[model samples]
Target: MLHIRVITPASRTDEVLRIAADSPAVVNVLKLPGAAFDPEGDLVEFDVAREGANAVLADLKALGLKDTGGISVEQLDLSISTAAEAAEHAAPGDPEDAVVWEELSARTAAEARMTWSYFAFLALAVQIAAIGALLDQPILIVGAMVLGPDFGPVAAMCFGVLQRNVRLIGAAARTLAAGFAVAIAITLACAAVSRLIGWIEPTMLDDRPLTSFIIHPDRWSFVVAVLAGVAGILSMTARKSSALVGVFISVTTVPAAGNIAVAIALAHWNEVGASLVQLGVNLAGMIVAGIATLFIQRLMWSRLGRHDIAPHSPEVAAGQPTSGRVSG
Candidate 1:
């Protein structure tokens, strides 16, 4: 279930009430007239089944409430009302399978921001990966993979393509390119310092099977990248974050970049080239696979009638019948 809060202008209060009345999935409706001081409007709140939330939100958006006032939705973890239960039962489709595009877009937008903290995490993860590669420690490599934040922009790129938002796509691309570039450069500097201290030597990087795995690109690397991409997209769409952690550990993007940094410090140009190939291959595979997975999932949902509750035309929603009380 989801809790919806809307601030409606005095002129549109009737329309808001009518829309709420028409939505069978909404329950526990409340209205407070002239309750918004800043917006100078009435406040309307209700609970709706998760399966029907997207439709309600879309309708609210079409009403221009989000611009004139505000519309906010919060997940309801616990709702014990009989009305809530009835609303959930009346709403069609499985809540778990529902893809709230607005929510997903908002989440990805936040994730795609290239803040200082983002670079810090990415650079720190790469540094850890560099040490792991030098010592042939699989555990530290896996740890770095978990700490990396590359999936945010990657997922945003896929979302931007689906929504045809060029700005979002560009922003996500910039965040990714800049984040990785800085991380790699910083790791390279760290590698130089480590080499000076004798902590990272050419001998540690040569003929070590584990380190070789980080530098070498093969068919299996692409395969794993594709698999990780699928899992990552699914986890995001389904809001299953635990599965996303597994996806992170399954890909070699960070470790390969770390290997490149170390190889450059050690003057292993051949290893550097191979590691670059590995990084490029995994990134390409993941993005392509993520785009494909999201497309298919959206198509499947649309075909299943799960996506049929988009906002009605303005005229249509305006003509919708009202069935509930509107105080004030």
Candidate 2:
């Protein structure tokens, strides 16, 4: 169930009210006239079952309520509602689910536009990579993978393609490229510093067999990438974020790339080339797997009709401004 707050101009209050009243999924409707100060509109509040949320929102949007006044859909914590029984009884079973490509695209773009912390995270990832190389430790390599923030943009790119949002695709791609460039540069610099201190020897690259994980290209690496991609996407859509830990372990991109940077800093040409190959293999595998996973999940959701999860109404909160558009 979702709580929808609809705010519409005085002239269109009647139409909005009628829509809510007639909606079978709406269990309670409350109206507060002359309550809106900014934008000066009436407020209409209602509760709708999750199954019918999409339909109700679409209908209200067609009425131009969102454009002229406002419509906001907020997910309610079901634990507090005293009318839980009534709400459950009124709730429709999962409806046919369809992929809202546009919504998914918007979501991807929004996530890509992360704050400066993203850069910091990248820097930390490079440092971890440097550490892994100096100590010749796979555990540190894995830690770097978990620390890398590269997954956000990668996931965003996959989502953008699924939704066919060019803007999202562009934004995600740009962020991803920029982040990696920075990480590689930092890792290279760290490698140089380690060499200067004699903490790491350039010749060690020729003998270190464990570092091969970064550059080894094979079928199994692709398989790992595909599996990681699926797990990453599922973590994003579902509420289980802890699953991403497993995803981090599955993909060798960050660790492999970091290893390559360290090898390059040490002037190990052979290792550098191999690490690059490993990075490429991991990337290709993840993208293919991510796209496939998204397609399958959408198909399943649409068949279940779980898309409708909010009411169509513009209710401007105390300080919240309505953008008048549905963002994924």
Candidate 3:
């Protein structure tokens, strides 16, 4: 279930109330007229089934509340109302399978930003992976995978292609390129320091048994990446974020990049070549798999009449703001 709060202008309060009253998915409707101070309007609240939230939000947007006032939505952690249960039972489709495109796009787009913290996390993950590679520790490699922040830009690019948003694609590309570059450079420096301190022995790279996974690229690596990509995107759309941890460790993205940095520092040209291939294969597989999964999800939802997202305009495709678009 989801809780919705809408501040409606005086002229449209009745329309908003009517919309809420008519919707079978809405329950516990409350109206407080002349209560809002910010655009100075009525405050309307309701509980709606998660399966039907996108429809209600679309209706609210059609009424222009997003422009005249504002609409806020949050998941209801606890709803004790029998009416809410009836609403959920009455609403068609499973809430777990629902994909709110506007929310997902906005979220992934935000995650694609090239902030200082983003770089720090990526670089730190790579450095950690370097240590894992040198020590041939699977646990540390998995830890680096979990700490890596590279998935955001890849997901953003997939979202951009689905929405045909050129600016999102551009921003994600630049952030990804810069992120990998910075992470690799930082990992290289860390590898040099480790060598200077005699922390990384030459035999670590030569007789790497447990760590060979990071530098080896093959069909299995691509297959795992594809599976992880699908699982990752599904976890995001379904709001089952705990599943992302599995996705994080299922592929060797960060570890491969880290191996590349360490191998270059140690002058292991063959290992460097293999690690580069591994990195490229994993990244390509994830991006392609993500795009395919999201496309299929949108198609399936639209066919079921469960998703009613508006078609993107030219401005929206360019990543410019649209009038009164509501997202949370």
- How would you order the candidates by lDDT, starting with the best? 3, 1, 2
Best model number under TM-score = 1
lDDT of 2 by residue, 176-264 (tens): 77777788888788778878998788666665567566667788998888889988887765534688888877787777667767877
| Per-residue alpha-carbon lDDT of candidate 1 for residues 133-246, written as tens digits (9 for 90 to 100) | 888889999999999999999998888877667888899999998988899999999889988997768887877776678876899999999999999998997889999999
| Candidate 2 Cα errors over 4 Å, as ranges | 14-28, 48-52, 82-106, 209-211, 305-328
Better of 1 and 2 by TM-score: 1
Cα shift from native, residue 222, model 2 (Å): 1.4
TM-score of each: 0.91, 0.79, 0.91
Give the TM-score (vs. native) of candidate 2: 0.79
**Which stretches of model 1 miss by more than 4 angstroms?**
307-328
lDDT of 3 by residue, 262-295 (tens): 9988888898889989988988999999999999
What's the lDDT for all of these models? 0.82, 0.69, 0.83
* Model 3 spans > 4 angstroms off: 310-328
Better of 1 and 3 by TM-score: 1
